[model samples]
Target: MGEEEVSNKQIILKDYVHGFPKESDFLLKTSSTIKLKLPYDSHDAVLVKNLYLSCDPYMLNRMREADASYPTPFTPGSPINGYGVSRVVDSSHTSFSKGDLIWGITGWEEYSLITDTSLLFKIQDADLPLSYYTGLLGMPGMTAYAGFYEVCSPKKGETVFVSAASGAVGQLVGQFAKLMGCYVVGSAGSKDKVDLLINKFGFDAAFNYKEEEDLNAALKRYFPDGIDIYFENVGGKMLDAVLLNMRLRGRIAVCGMISQYNLEEHEGVSNLFCLVIKRIRMEGFVVPDYYHLYPKFLELVLPHIRDGKLTYVEDIAQGLESGPAALVGLFSGRNVGKQVVAVAHE
Candidate 1:
């Protein structure tokens, strides 16, 4: 596309979310003109052509008001921001050059002016599909690595349970746990996802959480011994049930609470008192805090991927226009794997 032909299509927030977000909550609009060149005097910034965008559960929290307790919310009528892989078209930044591929926080648009260039990391391994940066090679991958290794601190032969096991992060956590010689079990919402966990990701066992009449009983059935580490993805009832089945000095890494995200009021875990009885340790963490270790994470996961010892699955939406539906699908288990929207190709 020539400079004159460049145009920007953006997905904008329509309003603050009250309950579960719908497609109507966003408005897709196009700009009349999109400049391929960065402003001449601009310093430490790069203009990028966004290729793909990630749809993650954490983005749901940003749809609400900017409460003092949580991170800042998305501004209404503005383009929503998330992790994306992009190609630099113009640069006034020293660290990046034209045609360099990068990934980090970028707007949901065809083009974005990234002022904080430090946040973007240059893509070194183009041998892998660039879209991998949206999930397995990006934030979700880092989340699974840090949450499991740094937070949970697993040991061999330990029993680990992951909720939302077929989703991006949960799937990786389960695989990583298995590789560490742990007896790993995961719970997903559907029979198909359960099969993916066990058959594809090599989980020791998996069950459809929806079919279980009693979550505690289901946990006991899967881990007849006891859960030594729980990689929490869907909180609420699953967390409550897992609490009852934890071994002494168990570890819980609170990565996400997807079940509670869209509720009118967050559900409380009634069995949290089990933490005291079992001497369990529970902690919550964000992936960005561990960004410094990304290079190290790549060194570990990349080899596994190359050797076919690790597998990743993605559910891709075709264009920027599909971003709204893809994002809203996360809450309803509408996405089969890591949900991503392809905006443009380099």
Candidate 2:
């Protein structure tokens, strides 16, 4: 058992995609093999057996040709990599040891040889579901925390509007807003997701965006006094609608734009004048910028989780073979909540 070779199944991106991605866009190779141990001279490198993988909308951008913004696109012939929960099988780094549970950037394969340990974070509390690290306790959770408290600078009792409100980050934003005594409303693609927002996440109000013919009017009906904070997740038309409905001195934290990710030409928003007229402040944020506060964020959220003041939903697809479809489903709004691919039990 010292150094064993194992069959490694991997999900590889076939090529750069032009539009909405299909399952066929990925190539699943089951014949790959990886050693259970790191090389003798391997320094600062660790070999891990992946447990769970996150399927996020931003991965679509990474599937495109490398550009200034997406400089590190997935290599066509290599395994696709994203945030995942893994167990260390072998480690040459002092920070990690064998059998350590961690969540960070890892490959879309059964086993990953992580040479870059900069992003890796060890899981301190193994009692909490390890899969939560893929969503609620991992990158998406931090994104919501930073975007809401840090970027938006929300005040209690303020009215909040979150788009793509049932997804990973948006769902947490809604709950965080409610915990702050803010009136929170969310928009989702389906009625079931809308129900999840209102019933499950304690959103003040929720709506199915697909059923609404006019998004701007829909927002106006719900937010009579106007929105104080807008957690921007879906861009394009949704942004335009939210822009018109925003209150004076409103703050917009732009976390993601899932709606426009697959488009050849991103849809234009024609409401720039509203920002200046209303004296609104809108800023974009990346979670890494606030990674330093991870410990502090956990301190605030962990208690809520323990006390049942917060709830997180996840749509899990089983096996490494299901990875491609699960990743593609995110763009189409097929997933109910945070989409995760479960590769192994432990």
Candidate 3:
């Protein structure tokens, strides 16, 4: 089929976000035929057919205004952007070819012209599911690996606590901590997710935060001896509760704060004073800084995946039409695992 005959469907941002994003925040539109061939005159660009798009909590932050402290915001009336797996259809860059498979930042559309080819990573192994690049083998995977090993500095036999335990990065963090011989406990919003964390991801113990009236008491029950490492995903009350239960000289890896994301005023972490008394180390991290260790991460994780020692789950929403609902579902704890939008069949 000719490229001119292929139409592209796109999801464009409505405008800067206020409190929380709604389905109306995006508009689905179709574009004319895609250009199969890259213009020879153009430098360092590649055209790709998107296969899968990731729905992550951090993307919500990007929808806000670009403050001096925050990263750049998504442009109004433009295609909403996120990490996706794609097949290169046309290229003018030496690093990638026309048929190469890649994963990186791409617009929420059927086709994308990646102006910065350097951002794309070539897919060398397809033995694993290609859709994994949108989740476990992609951004969330790196986030789990870097935040756990790099920031948390876990030692075998240490007690670990992960909030939002059944979600993308949290699931993997629990598994990685388990494999490291740590006693891992996780907290989820519902019974189903808590069960998945304990039974599927091999967490030593799991709890439904919704069932607990006192989060601090729940944490105390989970880690009677105190937690050596805490993976912070849901912040606010959960974080404050975790602070009260943290062991002396403990480490806390701040991967995300889903609880505080939609709030008009950011919630205060009242127990931060525990850091001083306990001499604990709490650090916030972004995954990209440790991209250099991706190869090393693959070396460690791929074997576990191949041997069935590791398990990854995805809550995939088929078609671009489901994109808005899938993204919104994260806030309500509707998705059971790593929420993804399967935009097309590769």
Candidate 4:
């Protein structure tokens, strides 16, 4: 018997992106190969067969060459890296053994040999769909849970507003707020997504921000008494409007600024005075900063999912080939829900 060869399909970044990303900015290359075994430096490495790859807006920032912060930027000639769910085929790590289902930072290929086992979470409840790990149970789920309960300090009957309502985190936030007996409203880019917020996700009200000429007027229409909390996913103009409509001592949890990600010049927020006038508490957050809270989040959310008290909608594109389109689609509002690429099913 010889070492088995595996065809590694990858979505490679074409070049360092300057502005908005296009499908052409990536190449679906199948010229790579991998051996199905751990190397000598595999003290904590786990070889995994990737299943679902999450397409999140934060990935756009990673494509830039300027932001050289933690995790670094995605290189020009490497696979487009993101969070994914996978099954461990081989492991040299103590925490994970062979055949264990795990989810974390894996490459956009068929097989990923992960060196960073620190972030990988073992899937204890395999009864739930593995695809859920890429969206609902993974980073986005953690974002929604932490941003709403931990950050917002939500109380019963409080008015909460979410931007990008039909998105991965936004949908879950709305659901969580509803469970807390809070008045929840969300804004989406399209009427379809708006309807999903109200009809599907049980939001108190929802509106298409694209149709609203005056966002302030729209906010006033929905939150007549003003917003008690704002879960910010889309930024720029939407953020400005929410600032003006916030109640005194309102809390704001900023998880992302999808609207300003690819802009040549970022939009300046002119609502600083509104924050001062309202005495709103606005804070930006990164998901990795709160990974320690994953166990707590899972305990709170998993039961709701099993009992159907909470639901998740995913806009899945099939195969590694669909990876490029899915990644580019996040900024264009092309996906209806949480955009995911199903690399392989197992």
Candidate 5:
């Protein structure tokens, strides 16, 4: 199939967006003329058939014009790119061979030639659902593990608070904290999500933040002694309240600010001064920095998955055509769990 042509259907960004992204911002186009294998002289490149594509919140930032912080924007006419689970069709790279199952950054198209394999993680166990590479077993898993174990540094019986607690990273963080013997409570967007956090993920308690009038009061009610660790997922108003509720010397790992991503003017966190007075340690982190811990993290997480101690939920949208709606659903809290776009199931 090296030289044979295949129609490549891609999700292309129409233009840079200003506010909340509509499905119309993306166009699904199919091209019959394409290369299905790594091109000649393509040093360290692998051609892959994408199986599952992750629809994450951060992808929204990439759709907008380049910012001072997020400088890399998706090319207007090109296929949008994000984390994906793929099966290698052909390779010029020594590290990867044809038929290898790998997960990393790839084009939103049906087939993608990945030039840089620096971030690619080989899928070893074929028994597990390959789609896990897009969520629990992939980037979001590493994020939850590192942010909770390495960054937060929890102790038994401590109080932990997680915002966006029912979503991918939040659910995993909540479960990890619970396993560490900490009292964990998560905040979700709806009653169903809140219930899933407590019943499914084994969170100590959960609440719908959308129903709360005062976030500060809500935090106070749950964490009477104040939160020892705050897994900051939703920034803006949530951050402001968490800053006020955080106990002295508490740690806040700022993984993302989904609330502020679509805004033209980012909302200010007014309680930042509390960090100084409270001796609280608040730092932002990107997941890629902790990729080195992948093997060890898997060792720690696998047993929990094997036994009944841990569970993960995913909202899968079938096919490349569903990419836009699936990705956009993340912002509005339409997705119940980890949002994954299934291209071709194995």
Candidate 6:
């Protein structure tokens, strides 16, 4: 037959944001249309129907002007893109075909035409929830795995601390530390999240950082002996406090600093001297650098998921229309778990 066409709805970035982001910072465009087939000359292109879009803290960096990063800045009038789970509707790539499920970096729209398929991963083990590919089994999962296991070099019986402990990445890190036989303590912004970290995730102890009058004292109370390993997710004040409480020769895995993302002038940590005095080893890592370990990570995690040894919580926004509000909510600690925007079911 003939080429099919359909109306494409998208969440577009209105402009570069200053300070905290708002729903109005993004525009929902519903008038666009796209062909459901690749161009005749299109080489290795994949046309996909986006099923779910991932709302991650890292996307905030992409909303700004282009930087020296894997994802460049989003164009002012174009669709805002991030990691997503999609079904292949059309493809010219050798490894993909119609009806196959895939997850990767995709546009924030009903449909997307992806030219670079290097980052795209064909979803295997369809028996699990497809939305898991947006967080638990996708980028965030890999991030938690890489940062905790490789960067932290965690040992059994060590005292571990995680900031933003109930977040997409931090929750998994705490569980992994528990699995390693470590004493894991987590810090969250709310009492509800603190309870989730302690009760649901099996963390040894958790505290509401928002309620803590003095963060340094709180860390001391949890880790009286000092922290052997720290999974740093929140930066600024928390990092400074953790620095003071770190054990000698401690290891710190520097993941995303969500606290500094929206600030015009990022908050400075005044505890660098702690690293020197404590002889601490601090390293910052990006997930893509460890993408090669995905297969190995799945080998270790999938069994735990099946056995109900690991738990993942997701906060899903209903539709493409909910994208802006959901994305903006990350900064305010409004989301309970991994934030996902459901664009379509299939």
Q: Highest lDDT: give the candidate number.
A: 2
Each prediction's number of clashing residue pairs: 0, 0, 0, 0, 0, 0
Off by over 4 Å in 3: 1-5, 31-33
* Model 2 per-residue lDDT tens digits across residues 55-120: 987889889997657527888988999999999999999999999999999999999999999999
State the lDDT of candidate 5 residue by residue for 1-346, as single tens digits: 6688889899999999879999999999986346786667888989999999998888888989886576378999889999999999998888899999999999898888888789899998767788988989999999999999999999999999999888889999999998999999999999999989989999999989889999999999999899999999889999999999999999999889998887888898899999998999987888899999999998998888888687999999999999999998899999999999999876
Residue range 240-261, candidate 3, lDDT tens digits: 9999999999999999899988
TM-score of every prediction relative to native: 0.97, 0.98, 0.97, 0.98, 0.98, 0.98
Clashing pairs in 6: none
The 0-to-1 C-alpha lDDT of every candidate, in the order given, reads: 0.91, 0.93, 0.89, 0.90, 0.91, 0.93
Task: Name the 10 consecutive residues with the lowest summed lDDT in model 4.
Answer: 64-73
Name the Cα RMSD for model 1.
Answer: 1.3
Clashing pairs for predicted structure model 1, backbone only: none
lDDT of 1 by residue, 1-346 (tens): 4346577889999999999999999989986357788766889988899999999999999999866566568999999999999999889888999999999999999999899765688999989999999889999999999999999999998999999999999999999998899999999988889889989999999999889999999999988889999999888988999999999999999998999988887798899899899999999998889999999999999999999998999999989999999999998999998999999866
Candidate 6: tens digits of C-alpha lDDT, residues 154-183 = 999999999999999999999999999999
Backbone clashes in model 5, listed as residue pairs: none
lDDT of 4 by residue, 248-327 (tens): 99999998989999898999998879888888889888888888999998898899998998999999999989899888
Q: Ten residues in a row with the worst lDDT in model 1? A: 1-10
